[model samples]
Target: MGLGAGPPAVKRRSFTRASVAVAVAVGLVLAGACGGGGGDGDGDGDGDGSLSVGVLLPGGGASRFGQFDGPLIEKQLKRLCPDCPAPTIAATSDPAVQRQQLESMITRRVDVLVLAAVDPQLLRPSVEAAHRAGIPVVAYDRLAQGPISGYVTFDGTTVGRLQGEALLKAMGTKARGGQIVMMNGATTDPNAGWFKRGALSVLQGKVKIGKSYDTVGWRPENAFVNMTRAIAALGAGDIDGVLAANDSLAGAVVAALNAAEVRPLPPITGQDADLAGVRRIVRGDQYMTVYKPFEPAATAAAKMAVALGRGRTVGSIATGTVDSATTKNIPAVLLPSVPVTVGNIKGTLVKDGMYTIDQICTPALRSACAKAGLTR
Candidate 1:
């Protein structure tokens, strides 16, 4: 996401023995702070230890936010504060619905909120309302504007760079003088702009951008329409590669190209490392994808939320600081992302415990999986 200044420099934070010890200590402190018995059980305005958390996500069901982030964050929260009330989780792609969810959390006077905003700008007022209610809002994945206490997400610029570099590498001889179509994410999410900027830094001089379109709502259908338009404007042969912002968009681009009957598919880049994206890579429809490990990100966000709930600063948890449009130098955890291609799928995705060999290698993809050296 775009910050007030330039993107913060991303330094890999190793989970050393000392870091683990610190994390344990922090968790213990939070547990002790929240284990007391007093005030209303809802953990509302009574100023008791009954920690209450609210989660807002962009989408649900098979999407990363649904399949991974939500469950992982909840799991981490329970581990940290077993006595705390079960968190209230809600998911929606509509900015209006997300705002209503935030308001509901505010009305309940939740201790803290972990939000993955659908539209950062649109949710600014709701975030402000949460702040007014003395509920600390931790911006998760997408940076929401307003007075947020902390933030946690993967390095968007790095994600874009990985996609751009992989696309160029996949293009091979065509890389010297190639034409590419840029299928970016939604305009409402600042991350879309952030990814686009980073990709342009690497792709501006190397390739000719024949067409570029920002897919509204980050929807695959929108991307498909845009890709079809690009094909009509710039013939399939002239389009050498596609720099799609995420896996969903990349799938749409691939489908559109296939529908147009492009003989040999062009190299396409994606992020999020969704299972479908990995399958596409094995089937030779997509070139690569960026995998932002969900465990670390969820853990970081959960810790930040719990600490804030206990009236503690996130100085111990945050690796760096980021400035949003309305908030300055907010405590932030900028995690790293890994690029996944057919060559490194086993080493990155499966080896990291994100997916099993059998999960990625379904019956239909057995031959392709074998060719890619992905076996039991």
Candidate 2:
């Protein structure tokens, strides 16, 4: 779950013009079904001496799922296998829908599958089916519960530890005995439990947990509703801080606090350097967010998928191994996550090109941007 000390910092690399062009072309081919399915029947092969990759993301609305992961993976795949048919991508929040999509890809007899399971356990049967069909599955972001050949994701427990440590720092003196609310991700996502465990490891003796809730579907509305309940039960003034699992939930928690008219909002922790989350940090609404460089993770997954499809070993690409509920010693590339506060906006997001000053510092955010030293 936790990768102990953070991984050595990776030097960010820029894509060449030719690779960018190919990525754009691949993007066009997979346009329509950004949150659904694409490609034709029985993808056994692209019929052009090329392999077909099936990518199933766990729905949109999280920002990263569609905006970052999907496109990044597409680009990396194209760059790696120029002749391969553009990957078939599908996105859904429902496990049943994901299962059906997986089955459809299996029926198409795709060469390989890159899946970010909606519910790891519920999708086991589909993964098994893919395995039986001789299609290697690369579990993306979340570890799926079947015979996955490889995994690509940030260290889950480390993500939690970063959030917890940031929360403690933001809370300052109050952290010694402050009562905080934990707004964790969906129970169906194994990463959610791992995150909670890591956070508890750092927070248990340091602070009192006033309330904790596992959001359903990792939906912001669900988080909003849960935050409202926590406020009602604990009283707004009694809560010291909020430990939100990700940026979406952080937004929901912030909204609930605003709705309750809780003055001088408490420090809130989040993961995923989402634009809104970064904006929140600039405005002093959110204390910090974890930034997991997605390009490298996407590149690793793309390489693994393509290699597996070609019957090549992935030992060189995998940095480590992880155990799923039903599988053990699965090869994995566990990337490190960086803690991004207002102080390091330039070093993290801006430096990595995840966001430019112009993008982050809109007309409305110019003042905050300037104050945060984001002037360009």
Candidate 3:
């Protein structure tokens, strides 16, 4: 997660001060290259028998990026290619930083890149550069622009629809022409648009959208500010439910509702079955969160990266193809997602081994967990 330690140091060049400085400087460059570099490949274009995978994750506050996707992808890659070098994994919320990281990976000549772009449009040039360098890019989790060879992610529309349907269920009678707020993810992410489209398909004509905001950076603070403003505009009593883009935004929305002293908080929908989100559901704060199983998607991405690195076709592994803003008919594997409520925590997260009962039912949550029938 921390990109491991820097590569080992090189020996001193000479006793002279200048030589020593040169050696140290050269050592740092070598360290960076080694840390980020992929395995060597022959001109045959199939990379050497040993493949190096460069994985770029879009930040880590979501929990899944560091806790599940990173480790699971590494494990699957090892299973598929024992001799493959450990993936050069990097993550940052800043779009510029992510772009620089992608360029570094491309310069290192990594056979393949697995990228979850922080900003799809901003990363297009770098993705194009990778393509020019003959490195296949596999867009992971989020579909990126520019000549991507493959993609692996859950059905974005389905995820949003599930969240919308669950919010309606939680709202019950109020769902009949109720007033709801929409907290969408960053506009930079293509999936945000897909999710909004899908949620609109279910929520339109059925509910009054009192307020909607496109959160920047997908940051909780941004969501909090938006939610607080929404609360001010709509007043507590007028709001019936909230359509939160993900668990992080959901948390922020809940915080704002609490700050406004709204008693008996309205139903809130979220995606990414983050632990905090799950606990919030048990405590009756959040209505539900969509669980997009990470293992299968991670496995598929790893296998695709490996296959692409080996100059092999991903058709065998990709279940379908997707078109991006800049690319068409790109091979893809779109997994399914499940809406998780307090009642199905055990049947979903627990059963999937994403969490243990003890992990969810902490001492503080014992009573809540018991009431939710999550004990033992």
Candidate 4:
């Protein structure tokens, strides 16, 4: 949700397939030579022909992208198709970088390309190029419009409602008369709008929205600047809560509040139970984060990509389908999310094997972890 290719700006110039594709292929061959296949899916553990898969992530800046999405996806791809060419993966912080990565994957003629687009519309042509090349593109996380063979992401509305409900609960006695700020994600992302709509469904009349801002790039720094402005306009004491779209933005919000010296900080909500966010909850700085298990979601995407690569239907890969604005009734894997508060940090993230106690409790947070009942 943090990924934004900036504003629509100049719609992608007419794509030059031959120009970008050739360069991309050369780059891939060089990178592949260095990325030893090892036990990666290149082995076709299932005794099938070797498969080649490519994955392009939006950014590595969002800690979750590197820490959770990357390894989980690589591990699952190998489990689903041990003989597939070791999966090719890369991260680009900008849309232009993602476009170059897309073209390279296409040039390599990968069996399937899995993308968590930085900007779906601009990436549409690249996805279409893959389609024309007889390659299927599995839209992972953010839906990239095209003849997408499959889609995998947590239910957007459900994730939003969970965040909303948690925010209200955290507000407790303040819920009745409190005014809060809404720090949402980039408007370019359809998921961001879905999150806002779902949250408004519950937050509409119950709480007074003092100020709302659609974050520029889902960047913490952007959220920080915006939060600082909100504090200046609304005064620190009057704001009772914050609705940060994700853990990254939530962290920014908390930092801004801390700078403003907001004592007994107001309740804030976030998604993507990031370790820092969980640690903050233990120390009682932030309120909660939504834990959307990465394993099942990653597994579903890998299975779909492998199935598509082998010229098979996504029947086994999808639990259902979703209707997108540009595309109707797309094959999809809808994952569930759980709201995580200080009281249940262990029961959710720790128990799910998402993060170990050691990974979570550093020397600085050791005491806080103990206070949260996480001592082992």
Choose the strongest candidate by lDDT: 1
Order the candidates by lDDT, highest first: 1, 2, 3, 4
For 245-284, candidate 1 gives per-residue lDDT tens digits of 9999999999999999996999999998899999999999
Clashes of each: 0, 2, 1, 12
Model 1 misplacement above 4 A: 1-48
TM-score, predicted candidate 2 vs. hidden true structure: 0.87
Q: What is the lDDT of residue 131 in candidate 4?
A: 90
Candidate 2 local lDDT, 1-376, one digit each (tens): 2221122222222222122224333333322111111222112222334679999999765578888999989987776666777999999988999999999999999999999989887888899999999999999998888898988887777788889999999999999999999999887887888788878889999999999998998999999999999999999899999999999999999999999999999999998899999999999999999887777778778877877877766665566677666777787776667788999999778977889998888788889999999987
The TM-score values for the models, in the order shown, are 0.89, 0.87, 0.87, 0.86
Candidate 1 matches the true fold with a TM-score of: 0.89
Of models 1 and 2, which has the larger TM-score?
1
All-Cα superposition RMSD per candidate: 5.2, 8.1, 14.2, 10.1
Cα lDDT of all candidates, in order?
0.83, 0.81, 0.80, 0.76
User: Better model by lDDT, 2 or 4?
Assistant: 2
Query: Which residue pairs in candidate 3 have backbone atoms (N, alpha carbon, C) closer than 3 angstroms, thus clashing?
Result: 41-48
Worst 10 residues of 2 by lDDT: 33-42
lDDT by residue for model 4 over 1-376, one digit each (tens)?
3223221111111212121223233223212211123322232336557788899987775477788888778887776666565789989767788998999989988888889987787788898899999999888888777678888876677677878888889899878768999999887576777777768878888999999999876889999999999999999899999999998899999999999999989999998898888888888888988887776667677767766776667653455676655566677766667788988888777876778999888899888888899966
Tens-place lDDT per residue, model 3, 158-237, is 77888888888888998889999999988888788778877988999899999999899899999999999999999988
